[model samples]
Structure formats: C-alpha cells, structure tokens
Target: LILIILSPLYLPILNEIISIITLSYIYLKVKTILKSTQKKDNEELTYSLKTHLSGIKNFEA
Candidate 1:
C-alpha cells in the first residue's frame, strides 16, 4: 500500500525532470547549428567580396 501511494508522486516528478533535460538538449543543438550556419555564411560572403574586388582591380589595369 505504501508503494502504490508513493508511485504516483515519484513518476510525475521523474517525468518532469526528463522533459526539462530533453528540452535543454534540443535548445543546445539548435544553437550549435545556427552558429555553424552563420560561420559558413560569413565565409561565403567574404569569398565573394574578395573575388569581386579582384575583378575590379583587373579592370582598372
């Protein structure tokens, strides 16, 4: 009878903890993805700018 009485209380608390951990994991993963994507975008932009500047230099000659 004691076991049955405690089970419900334990289960809900355990489930809530698990849910919080899962959400934190997901949030971190999304943040990592965004960071990498931003890095890639910046790299591409710099590359394009370099190429354009080079073309203008050639034209000036």
Candidate 2:
C-alpha cells in the first residue's frame, strides 16, 4: 500500500517515541524489583537478629 511505502518518513520520530516508552517501562520494572528485594532483605535481617539473640539467651540460661 502507498501508506506503508511512505511510513519510512515517520520512522525517526516513531522510533524515538517507542524508545522513550520502552526505557520508562524498563526503569519502572527495575525499581519495583529493587524495592521488593530491599524489603525482603530487611525482613531476613530481622529474623537473623532474633535468632542470634535467642542463641545468646540459651547460652546465658
């Protein structure tokens, strides 16, 4: 079709828009992953601390 043939004229601007959208999507996904991992790490640290304190208590008793 003639429209398809002429699409190349807009390819530059379209490509730029697509790249911006894709980068934003990727950035959001990475940020969510980082936040979840940080929360999990904090939870693990608390659990480990409780275990360490319990171990100390057992030794004292």
Candidate 3:
C-alpha cells in the first residue's frame, strides 16, 4: 500500500511550470508549421522542426 500528501506551496509552482512548458511546446510546433517554405516529407519536416527549435535562444535568468 502507498499514501501521498500534497503540500499547499507546491501546487501553484507546479502549475506555472507545466503551463510554461505546454505553451512553449505549442509555440514551437506552430512556428515550425508556418516557416516551412515548401512541402516537406516526414523526415524533412522533422528535421526542419528540430532546426527551427534549435535556433531558439536559451532563456536568460
């Protein structure tokens, strides 16, 4: 058997983290779709998406 207790402090922090990650993922996916100039194959699409995402600057603290 297992039991878990949640802390009040953790909930808001976790929600913010998850929301940021989800929004970033969606933004990248949409940008990858919009930036392709020509029709791409599956491999090409994946490669382009990776390339576009890699070009994103690292967040500064």
Candidate 4:
C-alpha cells in the first residue's frame, strides 16, 4: 500500500536513468563503428599511396 503511494515519485527518476544508459550505449556503439571505418579508410589510402609512389619510381627507371 505504501509502495502504491510512492511509486510515482520513483518512476521519473527510473525513466531518466534508463534513458541515460541507453543513450550512452548507443553513443559507444556509434563511436566504435566510426573508428573502425576510419581505420579501414586510412589503410586503403596508405596502400594506394605506396603503390602510386612505386609506380612513379618504376617509370623513372
């Protein structure tokens, strides 16, 4: 019976906590995804640059 009376007071705080946790989880997942994509792009760019430089050197010889 006392719980019934107090439930409203706790509900909003609980909702806020849940929302914060969910948002944090989403933010971390997005950050991880962006880092992985950026790393892949860097690797590709480095490989292409190296290949292009080698091609130029071979042409010079």
Q: Which candidate is the best by TM-score?
A: 4
Please count the clashing residue pairs in each candidate, in the order shown.
Answer: 0, 0, 0, 0
For residue 9, what is the lDDT in candidate 2? 83
Clashes of 1: 0
Each candidate's root-mean-square deviation in Å? 18.5, 17.8, 7.7, 18.4
Candidate 2 stretches with Cα past 4 Å from truth are 1-6, 40-61
Question: Among these predicted structures, which one has the highest lDDT?
Answer: 4
- Which 10 successive residues of model 4 have the least lDDT summed? 51-60
Ranking by lDDT: 4, 1, 2, 3
TM-score of 1: 0.56
Query: How do the predictions measure up, each by TM-score?
Result: 0.56, 0.51, 0.49, 0.60
Instruction: Compute the lDDT of residue 2 as modeled in candidate 2.
Output: 90
- Give the Cα error of residue 19 in candidate 2, in Å: 0.7
Model 4 ranges with Cα > 4 A deviation: 40-61
Q: Which residue pairs of candidate 3 clash?
A: none
lDDT score at residue 9, model 4, on the 0-100 scale: 100
TM-score of 3: 0.49
Which 10 successive residues of model 1 have the least lDDT summed? 51-60
Q: Per-residue alpha-carbon lDDT of model 2 for 1-61, expressed as tens digits? A: 9989889988998989977876676566556555656757767655655665566457546
